[model samples]
Target: MGRMSDEPARWTRATVYPDMWVDPADDPRDGASPDGELATLLDFLSGYRMTLRMKCEGLDAEQLARRSVPPSTMSLLGLLRHLAEAERDWFNWISDDDPLPKLYGERDGDFDGAVGEQAAVDAAYADLEREQAATDAALAEHPDLGERLRKDGIAVRELMVHRIEEYARHCGHADLLRECIDGRVGQ
Candidate 1:
């Protein structure tokens, strides 16, 4: 017995709660109380990261790279690339004497170059994971949230908050893009 001929090509919602992405018990975000400012910020950041991954789950290269809301080039693949680039910049900024070059070249290259190809999709995920790990390590170097990234730049706390804000915004775009591709919707 294999997949029925009448079954959809891709998996659709079949949870007890039809409107959500997954059952509450299966959600990956941590529910434990954070211990401090740094812990709280990190929790939010981690949750947003999981949310973005959840939005991109089960998508193929074409679906991941599909643009959403006419006139906007935003896509889940693009967001993944953009976030990777962002992590490199912000995390490395603290130790750099000068500004680093864009990971994808041009300012909008992350979104503009998000082609629907298996290699591109694989690269995006790899880049994001590598960058995220590096960023986390860089962030851990300075336990002080008040530590300034640069003499005239913002502090670690501010940078962390900004990074979370960026993820939250892009995750919103991911949500819409995923829904447009398939009609799946959830928090």
Candidate 2:
């Protein structure tokens, strides 16, 4: 039976697949294995991005901005903003030809400014979309992963690997935060 309106929130939702957030048939992530190094990295990044979004799905602005653990201001919304800023910093701003300012005023502004307001939530998502597109476009300009950015001495391959690491770590955080929020877990 479905939940009743008068009942309190349950720790876990009743589902056929209790260990996963979605059924395998309904999962949005591209499950197919990749053929090359670049494709593999891209695939993992794409899946992590989708996973982060799924973790935040059905959550309201207040829930999105809820603090993670004690003494840490990090939240789903903050992660979104931080990732957007990171995409710009690593891809666009690092290139000398298109150096740009931080999306937020300061380095920690993403987490510090995260508020439980609809406007803030909407802005964070929009900024993420814009920054992701800009970053992708900038990366497309340099097909050779061995080529270094004009400003940063690191190769594109290193940058891609670093981004994957960053996303994977944050996705783990998202998983814990989401579980604490509603008792949902898996995948």
Candidate 3:
């Protein structure tokens, strides 16, 4: 009474309908070449960034900044700003340069200040892109993931893995938030 060897893996993403945000063929992240660890990690990171943007797509400033979840100031706009701040922090940690002052002055300024304003929304997107690019540039300097960064010698691989984890967790939160906002689901 053993399972069939030819059967697919236990974990599958099968769905009744094409409920995903994008069609399989249209998914930019599909068919990503497994070039290497660095390449794979970077690709996944980029895909997650794209996913976050997609989740926020077609939404107005108010929608983007709405704290849909009660008792939690967690909004899509706040996540975007917080991500930018987090991305900037990692870049500083990797370089040990501490180049820019923190994005938001207060401890939770990133989220707390995510007001429902078009200007804030635009700035968040811009900041996220700018910080991501800066981090990518700094990351290119170290090809060896095993290499330790200057600040406290945190390995490059650890940092990359952490970035992926952070994005994935937030993306899950986003799925819920977006569903609550407009009933749209699937990634």
Candidate 4:
């Protein structure tokens, strides 16, 4: 018989990747050996990005847009939208001071737009791609990872680290949300 509880245990041993990390001890931020702190940060961000992608793979638009949890506006699609905005907000706005307007519109709930629809899913992914490319370009132009950016008079490196932290947290959310949606989870 199925449990009567609404709160389901979403994760299982079979669903999670057992050996995803190459070497936990080997820090990605090891100094001066070609791959510097910036490279390490980028690599870490890319890893989470790929993880998010894998978590959503094979899911249809409706599934991707499902909220999975009650009282939260955090669908996989919403996360994609949020991340794209975050990338642009930090790299394009704070770092480069780009004047480009925000994507996905200006409504407070714009990220939640077209929820459970194929068009929304496609738009979220496309926004992510565009924002990611812009972030890479901005990073490429900067080159000096050590150079500090003063955003609203705050240090830019601090903001960048915060951005990385934000993605890592959201990826964790995606892990659980994806598992809840379809019992598929890993990496």
Which candidate should be chosen as best, given lDDT against the real structure?
A: 1
Question: How high is each candidate's TM-score?
Answer: 0.88, 0.88, 0.87, 0.76
Question: For candidate 3, which ten residues in a row score worst on lDDT?
Answer: 6-15
Pairs of colliding residues, candidate 3: none
Alpha-carbon lDDT of model 2: 0.83
- Runs in model 1 lying further than 4 Å from the true structure: 1-14
Instruction: Give one digit per residue, the lDDT tens place, for model 4 in 1-187.
Output: 9768645444433423433321334423333533677767776777678767867777898888888657777888888888888887776554645467777666645446738888888888898898888777766766665566555553545656777798889889988787678665445
Against the true structure, what is every candidate's RMSD?
4.6, 3.7, 9.0, 4.9
TM value for model 4? 0.76
| lDDT per residue as tens, model 1, 65-184 | 988877988999999999999988886677665665678998899999999999999999999999899889878988898888766677989889999999999888887778788877
lDDT of 2 by residue, 1-187 (tens): 9756632343444366767787677788947889988888888888888888998899999999988878998998899999988888886644666468888897699999999999999999999889888777778787788887765477888888888898889999898878767777747
Error of 3 at 9 (Å): 32
Q: What are the Cα lDDT values of the candidates?
A: 0.85, 0.83, 0.84, 0.70
Model 2 clash tally, residue pairs: 0
Tell me how far the alpha carbon of residue 127 in candidate 3 is from the true structure, in angstroms, after superposition.
Answer: 0.5
RMSD of 2: 3.7
